[model samples]
Target: MKYSYYALFTTNNQGRIEVTFPDLAPHVATFGNNLPDAQRMAADALVGYLLTAESLGIKLPQPSSFQDLTPDSQQRLIPIEVDTKSN
Candidate 1:
C-alpha cells in the first residue's frame, strides 16, 4: 500500500531542517542538516510511522489536503509518499 502525507519543514535555531507530520501525531518528527537530507528523512519517518501503526493494528488517519495547510515563511509544506510493499 502507498501512503501520502504532507510534512512541515522548518529551519530550527540550530540550522537543522526539522520535519513534522501535522496530520499524524505531535511525537512524529525528524530532522536533517539540509533540505535534501530533510526530505529523505521525512520519507523514512513517514514510512516507519505507517509500518509501526500497521504492525500494531492501529488505524491510520486520513491525510489533510495541501491546500488546507497554511505554512509560515519559516516553514514549507511538502508531500511525502511511501510504499509499504517495497519496504
Candidate 2:
C-alpha cells in the first residue's frame, strides 16, 4: 500500500531543509539540502515511522488536510509519500 502524509518543510539556521510530520507523533524530523532531497528524506522518515508503529502494534493516524495546518513564515507544507509494498 502507498500512503501520503502532509509534512512541514522549513529551513534550519545552517540552511538545510527540514521536514516534520505534524499529525503523526513521537515526533520525528529529517533534513536535506534542497526541495527534492528534502522530499525524498521526508518520505523515508514517514516510512520508517509507519514501520516502527506497525511493529509496536500502534495505529497510524490519518493525515490532516493542508487547510488545517497553520505554518510559520519559514515553513511550507509538502506531501510525503510512502510505499509499504515490501512490508
Candidate 3:
C-alpha cells in the first residue's frame, strides 16, 4: 500500500536538513547532509516508523493536507510518498 504524508523540512545551523512529520505524534526526526539526502532520509524514517507502528498494532494517523500546513521561514511543507509493499 502507498501512504502519503506531509513532512516539514528545515535547514539547521550545521547546514543539515531536518525532517519531521507533524501528524505523527512522538515522531522521530531525521537529518541529512542536503536536500536530496534529506528527502531519502525522510522516506527511510517514515518506513521504519510505520513498520514499527504496524508491529505494535498501532494504527497510522491520516495525513493532513499539504495546503493545510503553515510553515515558518525556517520550515517548509513537503509531500512524501511511502510504499509499504516494497518494505
Candidate 4:
C-alpha cells in the first residue's frame, strides 16, 4: 500500500490485460477480456496473494516500479479458456 505497486495495462492486439505486483513473487493475475475486468481480477488476486503469503511466512516486498518484473515495461499474454454451458 505504500507504493504504487499496481501495473495497469491493456493490449490492443488482443482484448485482455496484464496486472503485475512487483512486491510479491509470482504475483501476477490475468483473467479478462478488457482493462476493467482485469483490474477487478487483479484486486481480488492481490488480496488472496497477501493472505497466502502471510500464512506461508513470507514478507511481501514493495516496489516503486515494475522494473523487477520486466526489462523496460512488463506485458503478459493471458490465455482465456471460455467454457460455455448451454442446453
Q: Candidate 1's C-alpha lDDT?
A: 0.92
lDDT of 3 at 14: 90
* Candidate 3 lDDT over residue span 1-87, tens digit each: 788888899999999998998888558579789999999999999888887887899878788986778889889788878887799
Q: Write the per-residue lDDT of candidate 1 for residues 1-87, one digit (tens) a residue.
A: 899999999999999999999999685799999999999999998898888988999888899998888999989999999998899
Candidate 4 lDDT for residue 51: 58
Question: Candidate 1 vs candidate 3: which has greater lDDT?
Answer: 1
Candidate achieving the largest TM-score:
1
Checking candidate 3 for backbone clashes, the offending pairs are none
lDDT, ranked from best to worst: 1, 3, 2, 4
Whole-model Cα lDDT per candidate? 0.92, 0.84, 0.86, 0.52
Of 3 and 4, the candidate ahead on TM-score is: 3
Candidate 4's residue-wise lDDT over 11-66, tens digit each? 54565665655444366554567766876676566666655666788775654443
TM-score for all models, in order of appearance: 0.95, 0.87, 0.91, 0.57
lDDT per residue (tens digit) for residues 1-87 in model 2: 688888999998988998888998546688899999999888888888888877789877788988888999989898787886765
Determine the backbone clash count of candidate 2. 0
Q: For each candidate, how many residue pairs have backbone atoms clashing (under 3 Å)? A: 0, 0, 0, 0
Model 3 regions lying over 4 Å from their true place: none
